[model samples]
Target: PSLATLNIPTVWFNNPNVSYSKANLGEELLKFEIPRYTEWVRSTEAGSFHCDDTGLICEVKEAVTLTYYFDSWPKLLEEQNTEELHVAGPLLNFKVDAAEAVASICIPHFLCLEGEDSSHVYIAHFVEGEMRLEKPDRVEPHHAVLENPKFSSLGVVFKKWFKQKINTVVLLYHRLHLETPTFHLYLLPNDPSIIKVTRNLHLWYSRLPGSFA
Candidate 1:
């Protein structure tokens, strides 16, 4: 369908993972699977992680790696994005203390790369099931001409993540920022209900150490 009829915001998450690798759905799930068996980094609290903490951190690292593995491609893209896709709705409005960083990009990147050939656009898979969001209105073209040349022909719709029968919004990864890149997470603000559904469904995978039979 033309992007002009969806009643949901087009949350754009750019992953400049210089490797040019797009992750397969199975591979994406693997990144969430890795951390359970080891201590990759120092944890914020010295206690056991919540059920999905390991998965959350994996996504965090994937969000931070383009700078390192791709040799600072995300840095360059962020600089370009400052000009190229600014007209896009809900651009990466990262916080000063928390703009996208290398660490955040690594989690998701690793899930997609590892020892693979690593030569394709590393597109982040929008977990349609896990995102717990929906579009309730028709799509509309966004105007970004005054913002920047990078955003001239872009637009999106905004709605909410309906939060009902849901009492808490315990998203595993609150922030996924990467300076080497910009990892984004957007919501309709009204659909918190979908958030809980995805939260309840998130999972990680563990690869048995061996070549597949």
Candidate 2:
């Protein structure tokens, strides 16, 4: 078959939540659902669906949001060990007080999300920040919507309010960052804690020995 001339400069076939189940626990978790009695956003992806067609292509797709557990310190650290930090919430250096880490990172932090329907995660952010396509990661990062996300998405209040706060006391909260699918804007901790989430990731890597990095 002879290849015909394509219309647009690029032909993108986007199908949100393009299934890619393969050999691993991550793959299995793609279809896994968190057992919460409350509401939950669906897991999905953005596939070959592209606006390259030249017209306004509007379609409905699932959004990946997150809901955190252990809203407090003792609650969070209760289930965690040193090895579980990397896989938990965003990396932070919370050597101050375990409780401080919980208020800052978990209560008010941004973790990347994943699933099938995360093609243009930036699309949403661009519109919100009044930014353009150049800064996608700032808002809807693909890393978050990939699979078994390790971080959490910061809330709207935190985005607009506390973001510019210079002396805002922060916390660190990441137990077993196994991965859970949740969506929508989030909120930061309204209360103060005793820790600051700086670079807990270093300790995690250091424990990996002299070979992991």
Candidate 3:
């Protein structure tokens, strides 16, 4: 379709309710429906849709907005073991890796949110040089998106918090008298069980010989 005739809004492309099953339906039906939907929005001047030459643009107004800031903790290097601390709502200490043999360095960053509640944690493994967004090993992110997403109101709230947060990366490489270990981020749900699991993992790591700085 020509750009001039593409009167459809861009938001419609993402809406699951709208069907793009051309094989199931005839072109004539699509030809009729597209223009009809386009005309309806243009005539009504809906709040979500704005008519332009290319197509429609959706302007979704948000409700409450929260913000957060990030600061690197240099004094934390003196601590015996690595522990996750809540820096802010969106910005957090994902991980801190260090070694006593060489130098203990800490990298800080904020995870990117894909949707409400659901966000990605960036794990940095210098030995492998294969750093990317974290996801379930079995589920490919591209394929997972094709399936229906389980939306949560709590997730939406978290998503908004992340969207409004200050995104900054503080890479502080310091040679400490402590251990040289690597740090990484762990994504856990805001559930009671997960909280318990995190505590247990902390205890387990503490028991490991020379696990802490």
Candidate 4:
């Protein structure tokens, strides 16, 4: 699928001193299998995983498979109070037959904001087609800790009333075959929703007459 059709977000690095890393870019999907008698497991990117006493892993007589993947923000969430609630990281989903087995999940993020604090970051849980914001047990610059009672769509969000500068990337698209030689510039946050919107706009503009020089 083309970039315009895909739901994935675009990532760019503007720093001359920094090299690009593919592992850090794009949506990631990972799967793991827990032995029937296993008690704990660790995922390098998703953090440590554990099952509760009443969890499926404890009661079930067979092994279980866990699937973790990054997802895009739902339209319902994007239409809300975006100024007050900003997505700070990739939206993620954890799928397993044993939703009751999940005890806690630690989601990692790539946001680096100025004057960062735990009060502003939260876990956005998409439950029953509704967006529910929950506070994490621990919030740091790199990740947030959450007690996962149930599995659903989850991501990190930042709430702030005041303006603050954050480390971000800028995407510049040059319009070709134009008489005036136009160039479109977008200053976007690290949020996937915003990136997806910007990429769609870019694709639309690229198809216009005289866009290519």
Report lDDT (CA) for all predictions.
0.21, 0.22, 0.22, 0.51
- In model 1, the Cα lDDT at residue 188 comes to 25
Per-residue lDDT tens digits for candidate 4, residues 1-213, read 011111123432121123211211124422222122212333334233333321111122234456654454644475555557766666655566665444566665445643555687888888876888889887655567776446777888877666544545577777676567666565555444345445544454456676521
**lDDT winner between candidates 1 and 4:** 4
lDDT of 3 at 123: 24
Estimate candidate 4's alpha-carbon lDDT, on a 0 to 1 scale.
0.51
How close to the true structure is residue 88 of candidate 2, measured as C-alpha lDDT? 13
Please give, for residues 111-207, the per-residue lDDT of candidate 3 as tens digits: 2333323343222121222212223222121111111111110001111222222222222222223466544333332222222223333344445
TM-score of 3: 0.18
Model 2 agreement with the true structure over 52-76: per-residue lDDT tens digits: 1111111223333323211222222
Cα RMSD, each candidate: 20.9, 23.0, 27.8, 13.6
Runs off by more than 4 Å, candidate 4: 1-74, 77-87, 98-111, 147-149, 204-208
Separate clash counts for every candidate: 43, 46, 14, 5
Winner by TM-score between candidate 4 and candidate 3: 4
Best-performing candidate as measured by lDDT:
4
- Cα displacement (Å) at residue 182, model 2: 39
Top TM-score prediction, candidate number: 4
Per-candidate TM-score against the hidden true structure: 0.17, 0.17, 0.18, 0.51
